[model samples]
Target: MASPAGQFHPWRHIITFLVITAALYALVFFTPGSTAPKLGIDLQGGTRVTLLAKTTNGTTPSRDSMNLARDIMERRVNGSGVAGAQVQIDGSNQLVITVPGQNNLEGLTRSAQLNIRPVVARWANPAFVAQAPVTTAPSTTGPAASPSATATGTSGAASTAPSSPATATAQNEATTPATGSSTVTTASSGQGLRGEAAALLPKAASTTDASTTTTASSPSSPPPTTPATATPTGTTGTAATPTAPATVEPPASVFPAGSNPGVLTQPAGSDEAAFTTWETAAKAYANGGGPTCAQIEYFQGLDVPDKPLLACDQNGQFVYLLAQTLIPGTQISDATSGFDTQGGHGWIINVTFKADGFKTWSSYTTAHYDRTGGTNPPPDSMTAFTLDSQVLSAPVINEPITTPGTQVSGSFTQQSAKSLADSLKFGALPLAFDRQESQQVSAELGFQYLKAGLIAGGIGLLLVVVYCLVYYRLLGLITILSLFLSGGLVYAVMVLLGRWIGLSLDMAGIAGLIIAIGITADSFVVYFERIKDEVREGRTFRSSVPRGWKRAKRTILSADAVSFLSAAILYLLAVGDVKGFAFTLGLSTILDLVVVFLVTHPLVALTSKADLFSHPVWSGLGNVARAGQEHRAVAARLQSKEA
Candidate 1:
């Protein structure tokens, strides 16, 4: 090893530190995404939610599924314009989501499964069914039919059953209370409900002269047709239809009960019987209309996408028999909301599908078009866009959509349309998640915490600087410079880390930084004390600087090693904000080593060599060095006399 006196390349070491610091500053200014250190949610005030994964079959979710769900969830939160949102997998089946400054957790946490399904049938409130006589044209082999008919009900309100699919936002109709006959008007209600009633009743059936009216009591039963009360409209066709068509049977309904609605309650599995029972009751409403408004809202939470569902509008005014999903939300690539200028429609959400989705949607639209194959359109030709079990929009396939854009227009304000568009933009979660825990921090409180931490740190740093200057005199300048240098390095590193790895600085991390000031200051204290001890032992300040550094550096490294090791262990064992504390501690410890070796030691050594600082008063070695000098002179005289 080089002697302490020989290893005096102070300028070289100082140049190295300057170069490193310069490089760090250069990166801070030049690198993209390295603007500033990212503050953690706790410091910035935000909501944190922990979600537990759940499967339909009640099995533990796989790691891959958990990771995928986390990525999608993060994307969703970010897409919703929540800044600094983070999603991290905590365990095999748990996810922790943190959003800075957002309180609306609904759109951030929904399954958001936006599926397109065909409307198999429609059922109005039995109490509100029109009493007016209905008429229809004979079944003919032609592409012509009369215009749509309107049903006037007891409430004197008419709902136009258009051949085109109706938008999700229909007229604000009155809703009946769950138990009584009294009806109330609801202008803003969420989407309809699903239920499990098995009793079938005589539901009123009405249709225009252009349509057929049929009713089925169960999934297995054939639809029963009622005799028309009015004469059919005559139409010209290639083949003339028979006049006596009273005995002809009605067409079969297209939907089937593939799953049980009651499965939503059952933990073991779905019951097809339960689904059949609900289907029967729903069909009673579809065919004749008996379910009260109360029953509609009471059973509205079915989430089975693979089977037909009996659901109602938000107002519980009408129930629709919806077919299985024709296109899943995953096929939707992008969605946006804006005002409709052409049709004067209110705020509308526009969805763009992936290639496969476009093809499937086109085929469904074409197949359901009234002119396709010169046959009447399927009775349930309207397509509904559903999120979970709620019907968002059910519009008729007015024309074949071979391209990408599909508009969902209804009674939407700008807020609602934008909300739905954001939900659809990120697609759906593969696994369902139940929020296990939620925590929120307010901005005011977080700012207070941050202020308190900074004040405490400033006080500590101020005291340290004052103590160094009081005791070490001019040498304290080296300690101050070292502290600033270490701080600069740490700040630059944190900024880069925040940009590259999303490492955020939280309150606990600020505590770590405060503690690090002491750790760094300790190094300077150790080195300076060793130099003072050498001067007391009859050595010159110049020689003592190198010798002191050589001895004290080992101790500095050892102390930093212990600190770093402890931090590493803490980081590995702890979770949440504690990890932030440990990480910052460990990071500062390493940087302390760098500052001690390059900046602190070099500057101290260079100062010791300066003629001005070599004097006892200027060097802060005053009385100790004077006493050593006197002892050295006495010993030299004695040695010369003995020789």
Candidate 2:
């Protein structure tokens, strides 16, 4: 340990380290929000998806299912190019995900309803034997009969039946809906409910007809025969003939439950136009057509009070679509989730309805099971059981349907099928979502804010530079050199902090740097002021330096410690951008001590021996200020002689 009069101080190294830290901070922070690196949503945008827990035979999707679902979803989200996306469970079954620097994303922000739906296709199987259909033709035995002769009351539409497979196919195509029926499949009067439902189906085209599949004739086989025999009555039916009666395309969906855009039109008698029209309407409606998306307006052109169509309900993410015989007072008894015992292998869903449901469903669907109906047009059959004007299933009610909670089955994938089952069991969402706000953000504006910050920083730098020149003169070089060291130190710290602990510098932090400039100057001022006071009292610069340092250390430590404490407290309590201010203030307060003791003191000690500082012109101190500062040894000698 050296005496108080000793020229060198042990605390000097700590000061040097602090100056280096400040310099590092300066370099890193000067880049707008990054003067130190600023963190953003882009670097870390979060993942969002809606989830629906099973309500019926759909068990509340098991915890394991939830976990597995989370894993699968996480994989999908992370795989989609977002790095560092974190997925976490929100509630018992909910999940939340986040990433960095993902500003203004156009992501589908709806709850995820993963499911496996069976691929449903129309097949004209032999009523006698269940056979897969190769084409749309309902291959029967002999004389091509009118469509009315086969299935009675088939959607209450009039048309001739095809006894030959080719003609049956043409009838299927003729029955398909046309125009905007997809959106407006139903009407209030229910005058021809089944006719409308039939209209929604695709005109099953036979290989023999050009109207069947949209392809040209390859003159190989004979053209398909459509019964031109006027059905006992009168009505013109357009039929498609195929050279080869084969199914080259999928049959139109019968009950393709989709959004209804509130308007749909049916072309007069074209199979192609009718099928295409239905497709358009079902896909356009969203959110159950309850209310319009803020971006899309709500427009309900058709609906009835007796049988109102319900969109996605309380649990909007889930939908309850039933193909049961319509029952007005059916009460639900029980419901459960499909089991995935082998870890998501085969899933099956179940639901049970009350006794009343069993009775109503039986009556509502089987009213026209075997009954033959009258058709004013050429040949007609009663149409039945359609949701959104699309046939879900059209098995002629051979017998009354009596079972409660009837099971619906077809080609379903694991996720889609399960999702549908859950929705049917859980029901719809209660409230509707209306977009309250929608706006686009610009990086350009962010850059402008950054520019304003830089300008302010430049002004602070100029002031610090000028003050040092006028007050310290040649000695002021210590301030300039110390600032350079501080800037480097601050830069390194910020980079490491951002990369490791997620520290960032914002506008507030920039302000802290500016304020820090003054704090550093204060430290130097304290030391220089003390030295001047000592010299005015007749002490030499050497003697005054040690005394000045001793006194300034306590004041600097006390002041800086307060600043550090305040910053720490603010950082702990503040949210968002405010923390940036606290972080910079704390960092700069610490570096202030570094410049004063390390660069300022050491340089002053070495400069005391130089002629430049000793000479009044370079030192900037007047005769009055320099006093005995130049030769304090003479005072010491005279005092000793006097003693």
Candidate 3:
């Protein structure tokens, strides 16, 4: 190892420090769009939303599920293009989400309930669509029937359908058309019929007429004689022509009792009758009428995977009647959003399914899609992707999806697409969630808190500076310069960290920086005191500087190491605001050591070589050095007498 005197290269250390400081400042201000360190939610103000989960039955969700929910929620908030958002589970069933600045709390929370159900049918909302007049003529092959016949009772007003067994049987018999009655048949089923059926079928069915009427001079093929028609009594219509009767099948058995006992088996048969029955029941229930707040509450309480569901879109502009879930949301393995370059669809979400989900999805799509290029594919070909019982998207499957991946394409903006992709990728929550509270913090209030924190820090720094100057004399200038260097390094590091790792500084972090001042000052005082002691032992100022630093180096290392370890422990264990405090404290503690070695010790040693350091008043240790010389002379006189 080099001797203490040879180790003092004050110019080299000082020059190196200047270069580093210049580089840090360049990174802070010269980088494109670079700014000061980011501020936390408490310092910048933001919105907080609390959601309470509701059980399908009546119990709390498992801890694992709650944790999983929190993680998924965090991803969703982050994916929405919001930074520095925090998501945590409160107690057993509540989730608290905090986001910087104003956010769509409803949109963020609604994504938690991902329901992947098969779309039984879909149609545009007439209330939201332009109304076109319809021309009707008597059917040549069948009878004249009103196109709006089935639309009765499907008005916006709430209406009830037959529920009791007796009423249902009576209504079914009354609505059934006679075999020989005049009926109109179209090439398609449920086309152009108004009311419940209109709402259930795809948009393609809305433009075509249900009647089989053909003009006398028309060149089209003759209409089928056995065409089906909408029942005159406004009941659900059957197919234009019925196929052979289906074989009698056994009723579906009940699922085994468990936490969820209502999971129903897939009903057998691809017959038109089975499809018609399912469609009719679903539409009647959905179109029955507007639900009351109590009814909506009751519906929200139900999350059974096996039962048919009735829900409205997020905007509540249209209601949906969804079939039992063919593939649950949990089966989805991953989902990502991007633009469809080849297809030219605006934005799309690509979804990949697990093994079981792949099988279910492929089978469902195969059954509904028209493999033979048939003119009319079943309405069930379309699938509805819902979140919290609201349909996010409903797309028709043109071909069977045999692979594990599928894409949902629509006119989606980037933000909406990403939000949906994130929600789907995270899978569905086990329990449903209801918004409990929404709180907003104003920017002005956050600014006030930040100002107060800065003022407090400034006061503490001022007091430390005053104390250092009064006691250490000229050495106080060195202490102040070391502090300045340390502060500069810390500020640069904070800015770079914020840019790269999203490390935001809050009021608690400011407090940590303030405390670091004393820690740094203590190191300076330790080194200066050690120098005074060496001078008192008859050492020159130049020699004492290096000797003092050599002795104080080990003590400084030990003290800083302990401080760093404590800060590390606190940072690792603490959460939220406390973490910010520990992080800054730990970071500054490391910087303290750098300043001492590179700036403080080297500067002191260089200054000691100057004549000003020998003056009794200019040099803080002049008196101590004089006293030591006198004591040394007495010791020498005693030794000479002994000789």
**Local distance difference test values of all predictions, in order:** 0.61, 0.42, 0.59
After the best TM-score superposition of candidate 3, give how far the Cα of residue 236 lies from its true spot, in angstroms: 40
Better of 1 and 2 by lDDT: 1
Q: Model 2, 145-211: lDDT tens per residue?
A: 3333332221112223322221222211122222111110111111121221111122221111111
On TM-score, the leading prediction is 3
- Any idea how many clashes model 3 has? 1
User: Which whole-number lDDT from 0 to 100 does residue 569 have in model 2?
Assistant: 90
Candidate 2 residue spans exceeding 4 A from truth: 1-36, 39-444, 626-643
**lDDT of prediction 1:** 0.61
lDDT of 3 by residue, 1-643 (tens): 7568645578899899899889988988898534688787877877889999866545888898788778777766654221457898899899998876566665565544555676564433333332223222233332332222232121221111111001111110111112211111111221111111122343323221221111122224332222121222222333222112113321222111111222111223345455455456445433323232122223442455555655444333344557777787788788877866654445667777889988887787777753322234345654666655555554335455556766555446676777777778765555567788999965544888899988998898888889888777788888988998898899899888875545778777888999999899989989988998898897788888878998899989999999999999997787667877888998999999989998998889888888885565777776777788888989999999999
TM-score-superior candidate, 2 or 3: 3
Residue 181 in model 1: shift from native, Å? 57
Error of model 3, residue 499, in angstroms:
4.1
Instruction: Report the C-alpha displacement of residue 472, candidate 3, in angstroms.
Output: 2.8
Q: Which candidate leads in lDDT?
A: 1
State each candidate's clash count: 10, 102, 1
| Root-mean-square deviation of Cα positions for candidate 3 versus the true structure, in angstroms | 16.1
